[model samples]
Target: MAEPTLEPSTEPTLEPSTAPAPEPMPPRPAVAEPTPSTAPEPTPPSTQRKAARRERLQVPHEPVTVHEATAAASVALAGIRERCTSAPKVIAVELDIEDGRGQVARLNFKPAAGFKAASWEKCVRGELESVKYPARAAPSHVVLRLQR
Candidate 1:
């Protein structure tokens, strides 16, 4: 038997590619600057109504008696005393009750130990504002000292 001789193959070897690169993206368009307007925007109707209401409510009118003021405040604030655990022991409130509505003018609190007067101010004001008061000769200016 004759021995067979080994021969190298003649196929081409693979190599890394050198193709042309993709074109760069076009520059983004520039944004236009906002132009300043000569006149301010008009106020909405709802906002205008609210401003009118506030003006009407805050207008100075004839004043009511201290007795009238006290009675109205007592009725309005009774529920708050029962509902609020953080309520002050004593509260001095000044209010203006006009046209079936009440607005808090000032509030002073003698809070219990560890209690804060500032914390309860908003609650008291809200309660006062929610009350309905009969139209009086004028607005009421009364200082009430409520005790627990």
Candidate 2:
């Protein structure tokens, strides 16, 4: 009347009912062997890597106003772009804000052969820094970016 007694079951229960052991695997067949030929292969001439040229954008060489040069790369970017709506492809230019000293500002573009990106960014930045940038800051830089 006071308590109920329960006895534990004595049973060896197995989980993951083990399957029958598989038969021994057969050995793989022999692979074909390669033999060296007596004839020697000829070497090709040396070549240089070249940059890809798509469209030639005609960037006007004019005196851009101080205000217009902040995002200075707009016209050249627009000219270089294949599509109207998308932004042009940009490569980084590590420009020295000061002469020779490496206080760099970020500039992104591709320049023509013999053109220097660092100097160009410096020039663009100098022009803008000399004047107060407009509240609606227009692009002051004028460098070409590769069209996507």
Candidate 3:
């Protein structure tokens, strides 16, 4: 048997090319500084004064408990019942109380089975507003349902 001999294969070897290098990036344009006229305009004195006044008007007060709010509402309801000629079967009242004053947030009525809702909403609102809450009572939303 003849022994096999190893031979070198003929293949092209890769070589580095001498190519021209890419051009460098151009310099960015310089930004101009803001001039006084180009700067944001200042708020007008009247607007500033109004904002200050509003801030001063907002005074913090103590929070009103649920019990206190309900009590106030109950007292107001009595007054409302007296003012109406014929009170509805059901009265639903929602109030927003703040700074010892109550404002009617919502008022609903379910008239008696045989009658229609009378125009007593305005009277109820006025009566509710008349109820004086605690001097330091905070803003609160209270809902009350009253039935005859």
Could you estimate the TM-score for every candidate? 0.47, 0.19, 0.46
Q: Higher-lDDT candidate among 1 and 2?
A: 1
Which parts of model 1 are misplaced by more than 4 Å?
1-62, 109-118
Assess candidate 2 and give its lDDT: 0.38
Winner by lDDT between candidate 3 and candidate 1: 3
lDDT for each candidate structure: 0.67, 0.38, 0.69
The order of the candidates by TM-score, greatest first, is 1, 3, 2
Per-residue lDDT tens digits of candidate 2, residues 66-116?
334335433334333433233325434433222112222444633333345
Tens-place lDDT digits, model 1, residues 108-131? 733323334566666777777787
Backbone collision count in every prediction? 2, 11, 0
Cα lDDT tens digits for candidate 3, 24-123 = 9999999989899898899999999999988874545666666777676677666766787465768787767778897776667332232334567666
User: lDDT score, residue 83, model 1?
Assistant: 63
> Which structure among the candidates has the greatest TM-score?
1
Which structure is stronger by TM-score: 1 or 3?
1
TM accuracy, model 1: 0.47
Angstrom error at residue 59, model 2? 18
Q: Tell how far residue 143 is off in model 3, in angstroms.
A: 1.5
